[model samples]
Target: MTLSLNDLPLRDDLRGLTPYGAPQAPLPIALNVNENTHPIPDAVASDILDDIALAIRDVNRYPDREFTTLRESFAEYLGHGLTPEQIWAGNGSNEVLQHILQAFGGPGRTAFGFAPTYSMYPLIAQGTGARWIPGTRQPDYTITPEEAAEQVRTADPDVIILCTPNNPTGTPLGLDVVEAVYEAARGIVIVDEAYQEFAPHDAPSALTLLEGRPRLAVSRTMSKAFAFAGARVGYLAADPTFIDALRLVRLPYHLSTLTQAAAVAALRNSDVMLGMVEEIVEQRDRITATLEALGYTPHESWSNFVLFGGIADPRATWQQLFDRGVLVRDVGIPGHLRVSAGTEAETTAFLDALASIGSAS
Candidate 1:
């Protein structure tokens, strides 16, 4: 007989949990996840291969527990007068976030996030035995400083997550709003800058505000802009004190030798690896313009993805795109769907599919 969840013991809090990710359905033109999907330029690819080969030679030995060199690479790349002491790495940003929760949140603690944001913030907090508090955002998905500060005051959570260029919505959070929340909350404030590289030229990163705020931390990842999702490397910049706290919770040698080597190679070739960003930005704007012309309401995006509304039925629209071999995300919002900016050709293909189909159902 097959044993099911009912037959085995599980954590009471996790008894009814479904997995977090959306379906990774394969299709001709996949614009679902907010990934770069652009291949690394040839020279960068060659260097990365060499680094991988070098890392495997030392694979028989345990990896570096502190990932010292990797931390140094991150510091150099970030270039805000940051040092290795303030850098931290993990398998991905998710794991880095888990470290934050494990160090500062648990049991009696609680974490809060403004919703229609990244789904994982609450899930990660709850996984650490901390309660998750959901907050609200305006209809356009922007959270004003007043609303944010009010929520922070009311919940008084231990960890406050601010996801700029928020996932699935693609709307950015303002630095002033971040400051307001930080001032109102008594706990640590984490700014998830996973989409920072894609923001418009005038938009500022919360990293600029790190000077005097010891309690503020900013999270980033290689997966989106670097086209290194398969590498599974993510990192953050923050106070040395914050880094010290995360160290207590992270497993020794958490980042493998291969991951460190690959990430370092990518960082060293940052210019070439990031060369596609401008082109992708163009593609994102093209998508927005096309969507508007096609009568959909596309949110002004500072990220690599566009979130648009005005669909008659999101589920059917998702299916319509899927049927056409162009996949986009049905992010559970009413009358809205999200799609990532792909290569120029891929973007055209997605646009053509949508334009021909019109509103689905």
Candidate 2:
């Protein structure tokens, strides 16, 4: 006799909704969920361990309530003339986003994002009691400045979220669109740049646009390029006033001592930690090229994953790859699947497995 949600007290809006996540399975090669499958270098890992051990000694006392040193490190790493006063962080980007919603969105306020964007936007909105309004995207998944501004003007939401180098589909977003959307909306605007470190070197980040725009925020994470997903540190840059708002909503001393210490150690070794990004990018491009040669339409990607279409039966193909011990994502988008760029060996395994299954006829 298993009791379900109907048998218990639950929020009506969340009654039938499922949690946001990808399928987890043990496989020899996993490219799903867009994780950086590369391991951190040994030297950096050793340094992190040393820091964590020291932090453990202070476990009896609460960690820094302001996390001042961590914020300063992030500001230096971002290098858009940012300062500690404008920085905010949380356990992960998701928690940082939750704080935003809690501060600026709730009750009658509405949050807006382009459809087929990050799935968590709506869930976070719902959790904060904010109405989630979904805008549209072009057929190729790109959005122009005019279209984006028009949508924002029409929805007139209290919050707007933009995911650059978007998830599930590897579409790149231009800063012009961000500017236009910001001009059209009177509310808070958040750009989720969790994958920004994987973008092209010359590409300008939204941080460059944050100079005079007090309503804008650019959020990033150590999960992908730094291979720090297990460490769970995410941060954002915004106006000092805006950061103060998140402080109002964030739990007291949210980041643990060990977490701050580990992240600081990683940031200090930023160059060495990011060295793996080049290799991962090579594999990502390789996946794209091989996918096209197989008659699949691979979208141009700035992130470390490729989303391809032209699968005759996505579920069947996914199962075939899984049977071969190679796992990719079927992101619920018809005729398409996504794969993260793993180590060279893992990428080879995925490619071989995909090639064995013939292309869509």
Question: Which segments of candidate 1 are over 4 A away from where they belong?
Answer: 359-361
TM-score of 2: 0.99
**For model 2, what is the alpha-carbon lDDT of residue 151?**
96
Alpha carbon deviation, residue 262, candidate 1 (Å):
0.4
Error of 1 at 69 (Å): 1.4
Off by over 4 Å in 2: none
RMSD of each: 1.1, 0.8
TM-score of every model?
0.98, 0.99
C-alpha positional error of residue 156 in candidate 1 after TM-score superposition, expressed in Å:
0.8
lDDT of 2 by residue, 164-253 (tens): 989868788999999999999999999999888889999899999999999999999999999988889999999999999998889998
Q: Each candidate: what lDDT? A: 0.91, 0.93
lDDT of 1 by residue, 153-240 (tens): 9999999889998987888899999999989988999999999999987888888989899999999999999999888998999999
